[model samples]
Target chain A: MELNKEEKAMASGELGEAVKWAINHQIKVGNFFDAKNFVSVSNVHMMIDPESVGIDGVLFLENLVGMGAKVKIPMITDPRGVDLNYYTPLGQTEEMANIERRTIKACTSMGILMTNTCVNYQTIMAPIFGEHVAYGDTGVVIYSNSVCGARSNYEGGPSALAAGLTGRTPRYGLHLEEKRIPTKKFLVKFKPEELTDWGLLGALIGKISGSYWEVPIIEGINHNPKSDELKHFGASMASYGSIPLFHMIGTTPEAKNYSSKFLNRLDDHIITLDDIISLKSQFGKKGDKIDVVVFAAPQLSIFEMQKVAELCIDKSFKVPVIICTSPQVYSDASRMKLIDQIEKTGAKVLEGTCFYNQYAREIGLANGWKRLMSNSAKIVNILGGYGYEPSLSSMENCIASAVAGEIV
Target chain B: MKTLLKCHIGIGKKVQGEVLSANDNFSARYDLDRLKGIFSRPQHKLVGKSYVDKILVLNESKGGVASAWMLYEMCARKMAPKAILFNKANTILAQGASLANLTICDRFIDGDITSLLSSGQRVTVDPMNGLVSIL
Candidate 1:
């Protein structure tokens, strides 16, 4: 990979050991992908939850801080693993919380913001068309690339940190124009009516597309989806298939520029309502006993909080119900009394932490929560691997089932 | 007899280990029980199988970015696969391997790495040279 003068300087340790390490790491990744050069990225978002980072990753961050590492551009974080204010009651150990504290301290020492959100595209700043960013979290990358017309690949925590240190990423994958074109085409026969429907549709498409390299161009949706709907769609798709970018005809920004010829003779798969139903049907049966109900994955936006609050009014949950939202939305929700309304019915609204990445197996064991139900398809898909018999439903139904302590 | 398979040059050190091959896709956050060092996702082909110390051979990577960091965390606890071999790896797996310094190679010139390798087979992986030898 060709390095500019500044990049060469960083690689040569003229900038510092921290930056030299960052540049060398980027070079290894760039060479692996055959990147020609580096592209300046506007921002960086990192996913470094304590459960993922562990003690080793935290010590690594501290070492970088000791080396005087500071971010070159605006950098933010994904959801934290522990909601420090509310971890104990949710079964998180002190060791876990201590790890979280150390990680946050190390990050802050390096000038990184504790945005603590996977929904940064919704809650923080949405990247504009043709903008380049190095963002962690598969959901964030897919949303920025597909919905906002930004360019990014699935930058994991380490790469995002490297990008933050250098303010640039390798010029490969989604950064190049030719790679963004449709590799597969899908014609929708059924329209998604609700958030879960959209999520199911995205999950089905993602499962079919199956690889990061396959970009699916979707057609036949007559109306544009709202931001919250697209959040569930993109999040679920990324969770299911590891797909980073997608295009929806007449919906997404880049999709408007392409014609059907962009399909490049790939056969169009017709997506039907049965397909979505089949995917959802694999989870759980109606009236099954529920141990916990959750609303998170890509953390909820303020609008979603309002909707959840509306459903929670006057309803008391027999099973524990947890709602995870970004701190940005949490403050606004508190001001609007949305938090109170939702929590009035025995649901705990956790700020700045998603359910899955928060040491899910330990929490499940602590709470004895085997049969978990959630509205988010992404959460349902993830919890299954963590020893939970996850069931999927709509927000309204999830609330009602939580009240009844069964899948209604 | 030794069979040599070539692949695109990949990340990490050269090493030899037993192979744990499966045609299913992988994600450390989604399909693994990191604490147990086993494939925990019920739908996965390797469900309930231990991955520690073996070279994991899978079709492709799926799901979230947490795996990049999770790999390092797993390695820190001394409970991680010896290496990973994929037919095609997404950016996250490659980036994770880079951070964890775990051996990972993909884009095999030989068709379907899962078919080329099998469970319990001893093999040597040279990531820098993109060679895998069945021993």
Candidate 2:
């Protein structure tokens, strides 16, 4: 891979050991993908939760800090593994919390902002069209690339951290223009009315696309979808398929720009209501008792909090209801008394942490939560692997079932 | 007789281990129980199987960024695959292998890696030269 003068300086250890290591890591990854050169990215978002990072990764971060590393551009974080204020009740150990503390201290020493969000596009600044970024979370990458018209690959924790230190990433994969063109075309025959429907549609498309390299161009949506709708759509797609970028022919920005040529060489398929129902039917028993109800995965926006709060009013749940939201939205939700309304009925609102990444397995064992029902398709897909019999439903249905202690 | 398969140059030191081949996608967060060192996802083909000290041959990387860190954490506890081999690896697996110094190679010039190697077969992986030899 060709390096610029600045990159060469970093690679040569002139900028310090951390930058040198960062540059070398980027070079290795670049060479793997046959990157021609490095592209300067505008920002970096890292996913380094304590459960994932462990002591070894924390020690690694501390080592970088000791080497005098600081981020070159704006840097942020994904949701933490342990919510410091609320971990104990949720069954997270002190050892896990300590690891989280150490990781945060190390990251802060390196100048990273504790944004603590997967919904950064919704809560933090959304990257502008054609802007390059090093973002870790799959949901964030897909949303930035498809919805915001930005460019990024699904940068993992180490790679995103490296980009934060170096301010650039390998100029391959999604950064290259040719890779963004549509490979498969889908005609949506049914218009989705709710968030879960959109999520199912995205999940179907993602499963069919099934690779990071396959880009799907979607058509046949007559109405403009809102930000929250696209958030669930992209998050579930990325979760199920590892898809980084997609185009909605008449909806998304880049799709509008390339609408004329987007369909030329693409294989066509049609998505119907029955197709989505078949996918949804794989999750739940119609009237099985549920242990818990959750609303998370791509942590809820303030608008979603409002909707959840509306459903929770004057209603009490027999099973535990967990609501995870970004701190940015949490503050606003708290101020507006949305949190109180939701919590009034025995629901707990966890700030700055998504459920699956926050030691889902241990928490399930601690709470005896075997049957989990959630509105997020992404969460349902994830929790299945973590010892939960996860069920998928709409927000309204999830709330209703939580009250009845069964899948209603 | 030794059969060698060539792939794109990959990460980590050369190592030899028993092969555990599966046609399923991988993600440390989604499909693994790191504490137990086994494939924990019930739907996965390798469910309930221990991956420790073996060459994990899988279809591709899937889901989340947590795998990048989880690989390093798993390696720290001495409970990780000896190496990972994929038909086509995504950035997360490659980046994770780089951090953990775990051997990983993909993009075989030969056909499907899962079909090329069978479970319990001893193989030597030379990541620098992208060669896997059935021993």
Candidate 3:
């Protein structure tokens, strides 16, 4: 890896211990990927939930803070693990909350913004086409790269922090022009009618594409999906496949450009109604008693919040219903009385934390929440391993099932 | 039988350890119960196996960027695998391995690593040189 003068300075500790550690880390990753040089990134988003970070990560951040580490660019955070205001009721222990506090303080000391959102592209600044950024959260990376036409690899908490401190990342993977081109193609025979359907479609494509190296181009989508629909689609795709970027013909930018430049043919798999059913068959079925219902994964957009509240109005839930939204959206949802409406249905609203990252296994054990239901395809896929028997359906169906206390 | 395998240059140090091979994909967050050091995912092939200190071999990395930080935390607790070998690795695993200083390599020139290696096999992994010797 070739380092510039500034990078050399950082590596040499002329800048600070934080920068030195950050640069060296970047170089290690860069050398592994055979990166030739560093590319300047405009924004960096780091994921630092307490469960993922644990005691060691918190201490690592504190050490960096003790070194007077400060981000060189606008550095934001993904959803936190513990919502300090609402954890105990959800069966989160004090130790988990303390870790959250320490992690937050360490990151805050480094001048990092606690955006606490995976949907930063929606509530925060959406990176423009051709923009370069270091972003954490698979959902965020995939959405920014595929929909916004920005470039980023799946920058984990450490790599994103390194990029934040240095304002650059190794120029490999999605940063290279060649890596963004489509490697696989799919044609959908059925039009997805709901957000869950969109998520199912995305997951199927992601599974078929198989890995980070394969870029999939999807076709047969003739309608412009709402931002929330695309959000679920991208989130599930990244969750299932570890896929960073995908091109939707006529929907995403550069889909045509890259396909025209690189490929003569795009004949691939054809997706149909049976394929969606086959995918759904693996999850829990109707009549399965649900212990909890959640609306999370990528924190709810304000629009999604409004929609959820509409279904939740005057409804009484037999099982616990948890709704997670970004701090930015939480405020708006509160102001609009959407949160109150959801809460009136015996639901809980958690701010600045996604369901999966929030000590999911511990909380599930504490609450005896063995069977879970959610509209987010991403969350359902994740919680299965976290000891929850997760079921997926439309938002309306999920809410109805919550009221029934079983998959309806 | 003894054999040598060549792979793409990887991260971390040279080390030899027993192998635990699975054709299934991996995710430290989604597929692991780190507290127990076992693959806790009910659907996974290696659901009950201990990953600690073995050369954990799998098909590829699944999603979840949290695996990057979780890897370091796993190592700090002394509950991490000594190394991880995959048919292919995503950016998250690569970055995680770098931060944790754990041996991780993928893209074997010979064939799929899961097919080449098996549980309880002894192997020496030279990540820097992209070589693994099965014994």
Candidate 4:
């Protein structure tokens, strides 16, 4: 909080006015209760849309580009819509369309990749396990922190860039090795045969902890889950709560080495089967049937799509179905002709857009989607934005509700 | 004591511009965007909107460079608030100036918020009624 003489002198003149003004208007980074000195950085990841645009934000993007601050590091950009040039389901105003196009062009001129897709993880810069990197994706943040054993704070665009520029983040909280240790414990009663229901488990944990960053060591569940299942559950953890980290008792890179005796905090908070069942109950009204189904608020991966495909081949749907996937996955699936077969049935394969941004609005349900089903917890949270009640269920259940057109 | 602290931060070679001002703390956990369910919400809102040509961002480096970059891009399109001013060059502002390709003049002054007191809300260093408060 102390400024040296050089900075102190600038505070009096017009020059001071500019610096003081710039720092106060950006996105909220962390709890702020524990933030220490700010580090300047470049080549950060930013998410932008008109609706969420702020006065300072508009100026910030313009100034940076004009200043040529974006020349280095790869820029991973996500546009407001499923596609860069198209309107949202509600349609973009002429002004909105014009400005967005300009913004994308400005970024690209600075050498940004301009993916314009939310699923940057599927793109070129996916972070590996234990790779300390800054990211802005809410769902991806949860996935990397919990499932991948990587390190990152819940940084938005600005902070992400700062971290990238300095290549060093504040070495406190989750960044500290001790902080990553598990504190809570849960005993699983049954082994999950199919991993689609991992989100249910995450939802149950999210309620128990009430905040992100808490570590839960899960026990029980005899089956070894695939990578996809962990990803599904991690997305749910981030969706339901702000949880950035968690661990399985017998798995995870760090946990595997410890003889299950490591502890930074005690395993005081424990969950059981009854507790998980209670989670299922929370997913819906006491007994209201589902009316529609959506999957992939974070954009599903190929592994997740394959699970759905298998389920579809064995059974038939009874309601309207929508599943979202990253463009990369869609492309690969299309090459294999999976897109043709999936759409042939009742389901629609939406590319580039996630369910969180597209579907509910297209249906004219601004903030009131009736009984919805989702395989990911993040989708459930987005549904909550519109007053749509959601049921956390398996991939099969999501498809079933989609086909049924109502919760059965 | 309202402390009005300002610092002169030198711009990176790629940065440009002067100073402008805004009223809200857009990203301190709650805002119109995050509240409205918009992902990748705009950290600053001066783009293509009605405002002075050059701006002095009275905000935080919480959004880092991208936050500043967004504002910088707006200026590059002639839609920005003009120039920028800051209390001190934190990493966020440095990145902002770098990303926006705008020249920044940073200064540091220590006084109560009342000293800079004409009118405003939620400044990075606010000396209100002669009281210095850093939010």
In order, what lDDT does every prediction score? Answer: 0.93, 0.92, 0.93, 0.51
The lDDT, on a scale of 0 to 1, for candidate 1 is 0.93
| Isolated chain B TM-score per model | 0.98, 0.98, 0.98, 0.44
Give one digit per residue, the lDDT tens place, for model 4 in B1-135: 443444433442322233234432222121112222222223334322333343345433221112343444454455543444443333333444444544443434552212343333333322112122233
Ranking by lDDT: 3, 1, 2, 4
Worst 10 residues of 2 chain A by lDDT: A256-265
Q: What is candidate 3's lDDT per residue for A284-332, written digit by digit as tens?
A: 8889899999999989999999999999878998999999999999999
Candidate 4 structure quality by residue, lDDT tens digits, A20-100 = 223322212211223343332323455554433344454555665664443335556543433443345334345545555
Tell me each candidate's i-RMS in Å.
Answer: 0.7, 0.8, 0.6, 9.1
The most accurate candidate by DockQ is: 1
| TM-score of each prediction | 0.99, 0.98, 0.99, 0.65
What C-alpha lDDT does candidate 3 achieve relative to the native structure?
A: 0.93
Among residues 3 or more apart in sequence or in different chains, the pairs in candidate 3 whose N, CA or C atoms overlap within 3 Å are none
- A240-306, model 2: which lDDT tens digit per residue? 8899999997788878656455476666799999999999998897899999999999899999999
Model 4, position A51: C-alpha lDDT score? 34
C-alpha displacement of A102 in model 3, angstroms? 0.4
Quality class of the docking in candidate 4, CAPRI style: incorrect
Instruction: For all candidates in order, state the fraction of native interface contacts they contain.
Output: 0.95, 0.77, 0.88, 0.03
lDDT (0-100) at residue A29 of candidate 1? Answer: 90
**Chain A superposition TM-score per model:** 0.99, 0.98, 0.98, 0.78
